[model samples]
Target: MPERIRVLHVEDNPDHALLIRRSLEREDDSLEITSAASAEEALGLLEENGFHVILSDYALGSGMSGLDFLRAVRDRGHDIPFVILTGQGNEEVASEALRMGANDYIIKRSGLLQFKRVALTIRNQRETFRARREKEEVEARYRHLVENVNAGIALARGDRFVYVNPKLCEILGYSAEELTSRPFLDFVAPASRETVAERYRKRQAGEELPSTYDVWALHKDGREICLELTASVIRDSEGISTLAVLREVTRERETERRAQRMEETLDLVFRQAGEAIFIHDLEGRIIEANPAASRLTGYTREELCSMRVQDLHVPEEREFSENKLASARLDGLFGFVGTGRCKDGTIKRCAVTTSLVRMGERTLVLSLVKEVPERMTSHEEEWVAAAVDARLKAALEKAPMVAVQAYDRQGRVTYWNRASEELYGFAREEAMGKTLYQLILEAAEAEGFLQELRRVWESCTPAPGREWLTRDREGNRRWVYSTIVPVVQGEECV
Candidate 1:
């Protein structure tokens, strides 16, 4: 069953009121009618009951007229739909009632036809009133949401802002009136004006483009602010427009730029450092190594990354290195002289410095290794002097037919004779403190030379003499017979 419409009917005559009630009930059973003998009585009923529709006689026989009653109801905040009933030839009066806020008017007649029309009018008026009230409620909710939403909102039409929400005014540092009165591009930074204009034109033309992007905007105070906007085209009865939501991203972009600059600076320093630097985890596994570290260890960067820090130390020095690392972890920093075993199996005397540092949640070790000369103690000097004849050393230094050069375990020049300088086109001063690979050998040949030297160092004996096609500093290739031998002091090979 449909909900009953509550109708308050005000009439002077009882018979006429009965006739209207019977006719309306015959036409539609959904109406519930209550009669009032006078306008004053109808006012009392209105106060006591909630009625959906009001029907009143144009000429009430007492206190107030129909027009007067309509005015009173409206003044009292009752927005019920009201219909005026007037006699034939009273069209002028009905029009006047309508102007006074009457919803509709019906001609009075002595039949059921006029009352039937009244019933239909009541249903139509009720629906109209409900629709109007529902529209009002929806508009209130929309206004509240748009006003309180966190992001800035704007409606743009014909290159100007048709509407700007309060949040948008706050973001742009302008009043709502100022924002709406000016062209939207006036507030856009010069750098972004062209882009904003192009996107607007394309969107109005119905072109598919990215809906969200970042743009620089000018604030009221002349400062530039980055805003990330999400926009869409809206086409309605009022024509095409663009609705946009914006959020400020200035801080986020600044942070990203700073991070990028810091990374670039660190990379430049890492590449230019002279001493070998290594970063390893608590387990002594190498994580990162600079170019100098790779060259010093005679290993490719990728190969070193896969090895442990302890793996770079000579077998006899590994336990000592481990103890130093443990002490560095507890004390924050430690330094010692240790021997590093290169990939070619030769050992280098390095002054090792280790520091414990934290990166986020992980504690890491940063190690710096610089090559140093190996000095012999008195006992070791005595042992070495007893092993080598001073006459043979002097003879070899003065030999003109042979180019004899000796390198420390790290492949750095320890001794370069006059004949060696002529053969390699490098003076003794230029060759000293320089790696043999850097002085005369090409990168491809350095590995083979290191391998030969490794054989002599590991076995503590002379390597078999071999023929090598080497390059001079002037790019001339020369063949020479080379022999690699290790010098031992006591039990340790240098």
Candidate 2:
């Protein structure tokens, strides 16, 4: 669809006005011409209607002249394109009209042919007005975006800033004039000046480099600030300039550095600490273990990672350890005294402190384990020796067919008779203070045997005797029948 160009024609001569309207309508069907008898009537029509162009005669008989009408329209804040129509041989009058802000002028000639000039002039003036208004609107929007954006923006030519937005001025603690007057390099800190200068030089030389990087900037108060800058070379008719955007990253960089330092310190502590430390998931699977943990558990780092946290405790302590871990999760931190069963089946009384830690999206458990040293005074040792009846000990030592051994709840052997050692092909010294699994059972059978022992301990009943294929210290495999029963000491099962 063609655009409708509304025109207001002001002429005191009724004949000329009618001729002009007919000529314009014949010249272009899209032109809508509205007639006014004088400049006074035109001004009144302008208030009530919008127009794209105005055509008026140079002379308005007995009233205001075309120049006066132009001034009056402008004073009323109507910027409609105004064109003056003058009589033949009045080129000077038209020239004067142009100087007085009349957009253009046409000399009227005889007949309807001269009205074509008026129609052409109106179309040209309307198009020029539309283009100018669009340019002004685009420039206004660009200015608004640059001034109100959060990051500092600058346009630099050579080494100096050509333009700096309000945000840039605020960032450097300088007024617009103060920043643009000096070389941009003067505000860069010494450490980053060379790098920034090199990149700018390369960018100006048309060599492609990283468009965004970090630089240390010098604030007006002389403090160094870290800034992340993104810059691109902008080439135009005025030659080349660089458009740069700057954002402060001082706090974010500091946070990253602090976190890195903390991680390094923690890694050092984990490698050199005296006590064992273990990190595991909710399923009790070990994720990480420190060197001390490997030493404490008598397992290699690789071996520990393959085992669960419960696997490190004796069968009797499994329920207790589980409860402590649950408490740690609920309370954030918890500590307890428990027993740890080593790879060799020797048990240590341990003081364990556990805490729950959240990293990113996952929750983990951290446990610190310290062995509690066990020492018995001479009086205590003597009382323990006297507690065991001598006749029962003698009977166990002499038993030929039955191999008898006694171990604590933690699977640590309390007594190993000579007959038991003989059956397992181990001496009393080697069999004592060690669990039956470590003394005679093969590695593959250790877990299943421990489960049966746990059942007996939990139920306080004798586990059905079963035939077991086991290995000894010499790696000899032998078949034997074994059973486990919890001992009752008063009302409690030990």
Put down candidate 2 lDDT per residue, 1-494, tens digits, no spaces.
Answer: 98899999999999978877887899988899999998999999999998999989889998998889998988888888999888888989888888878898887777666767777788889999999999999999999999999999999998799999998888888899989899999999999999999999899899989899999999999889899999999999999999999998876676566457656866776788787989998778999999999899999999999988989988998987787666655554445566789999898876666656655567788777777655656565444334322423453476454577776667667777876777778888877778767778766687777787778778865677566777766788766666675554433556
Q: State each model's C-alpha RMSD to the native.
A: 21.0, 22.0
Top candidate on lDDT is: 1
Whole-model Cα lDDT per candidate?
0.82, 0.81
**Native-to-model Cα distance after best TM-score fit, residue 439 in candidate 1, in Å:** 54
For model 1, what is the C-alpha lDDT against the true structure? 0.82
Could you tell me which 10 consecutive residues in candidate 1 have the lowest summed lDDT?
383-392
What is the TM-score of candidate 1? Answer: 0.67
Clashes of each: 0, 0
**Model 1: which residue pairs collide?**
none
Model 1, 69-157: lDDT tens per residue? 88999899998999999989999999998888889999877766677788999999999999999999999999899889998999999
Count of clashes in candidate 1: 0
